[model samples]
Target: MAELSGRFRELQDVTSSPTSGVPLSLTQREPEPHANNPPLYDGDPNSCRAFLSQCLLVFALQPRRYATERLKVAYVITLLTGKGREWGSAVWDAGASFCTDFEEFRAEMTKLFDRSVKGDEAASKLARLRQGGRSVTEYAILFKTLAASCDWNEGALRAMFREGLNFDIQDESRLRLRLRRLAPHSSWRLEETLPSKSHPPPQSPLAEPEPMQLGRIRLSAQEKQQRLVQGLCLYCGGSGHFALSCPLKAKAH
Candidate 1:
């Protein structure tokens, strides 16, 4: 970490203005299409890929902002929390060389935390996955995780997903299959499987609408990104705190 820090300082020195002594990167305006802040990571092996992917997305979208390997790695470290933060702190204290290189940092983190199978291995596990006693949502999350590493097409994936579902869900999905079978000779029509408004499907009691402040307009994707980067409350665009601790958001609840 000392070596990495020294390298970063050397780069900063080279980039510093002769008159102002401020680094050129710091003087430049932030890039557009600001990336959303990734959720804090807790060193869960199952979620490491997702966390890393979010970090990469942020870096990719604002290449100029994260032009240096040190900057990219530093951004990732800021998002670490709980066990993840502990691991990052240890690496920093140990003076690990990989801590400053984005690719090396990613490789090291993946080796330590990425446990998901890929390719044929992932496919095989997905094939054997069962809904069992878990909710459909839970099963689907697991299914999608494994499917991400597989090379299967949509239709094949759909079929595999259906096969792993619980009997009840399978029975429910069969209604769509039945409709398809009835129009085997006709072109596929999605509307055929949908219930009419006159016979609306039952709504789940747990699907209540979230509480919202009156006259509060939805933020656009760009606005959300800006608020997040500014360290402002995402709910009301107030400064000094983030969304989780926003009093306005708490009051709405």
Candidate 2:
């Protein structure tokens, strides 16, 4: 009996933490994630819609065990500005009742924003997406983001992207980009499919010669050499048939 009691005491001591005098299960637990600060967002239709997306992303990215939809919406409202600033106040009424679902609050904000929000506007923006000064990758991102709200299939989206591409990109490049996206089975890349400019075009046999003046004749290399040696200057020393017409001479005044 005495030995059993001593062994049980030793087991208890081994399982407990010596520094804090607490069991591992009770002591080793992490808190739910909560943002100390959220990104500032105005109530504009364009920027606010993007802000809502970011707010949702923050919750997804953070490590949390018991975070609620209500908490997420509350955090999002805290960062609102302009007309958005008043929304935080109006969220709670006299009885302190407020929206509990994140989706409901997001929808409410969408309706509340003054300008045209993400619907037809989003589709229109995607249709008109152009590279302009932006890179192909950048244009792809903008188009894809706007396209999320639209119902375009892969082929139609590819066609739209090609139509809005910068004029500097050759038709071949636009075709390559479109083909790669349209054909799911084949493997192709923009970087790998670029045209090589290293080789010069072959000279055409039927190409026209440049027009020359009637009185002046273009000289052959052999004819010019023969004429160059024939000229001897008693005055100024120079070369070529130009030397024959030299008006320059040494004059003692």
TM-score of each: 0.52, 0.49
Strongest candidate by lDDT = 1
- For model 1, the stretches where C-alpha displacement exceeds 4 angstroms are 1-31, 132-141, 152-158, 166-253
- lDDT score of residue 127 within candidate 1: 58
Question: How close to the true structure is residue 249 of candidate 2, measured as C-alpha lDDT?
Answer: 25
Predicted structure 1: clash tally: 2
What is each predicted model's overall lDDT from 0 to 1? Answer: 0.64, 0.51
| Number of backbone clashes in candidate 2 | 0
Distance (Å) between predicted and true CA of 24, model 2?
9.3
The digit string of per-residue lDDT tens for model 1 on 1-253 reads 3454565456555543244664546435544486898999989988899899999998788765567887677667767888888888788668689977999999999999887688767766775777799865567668777877877654445545554555444444555565455446633332142343454333323433323233455555455434444545545677875444456655544
Off by over 4 Å in 2: 1-38, 62-66, 93-96, 114-120, 170-253
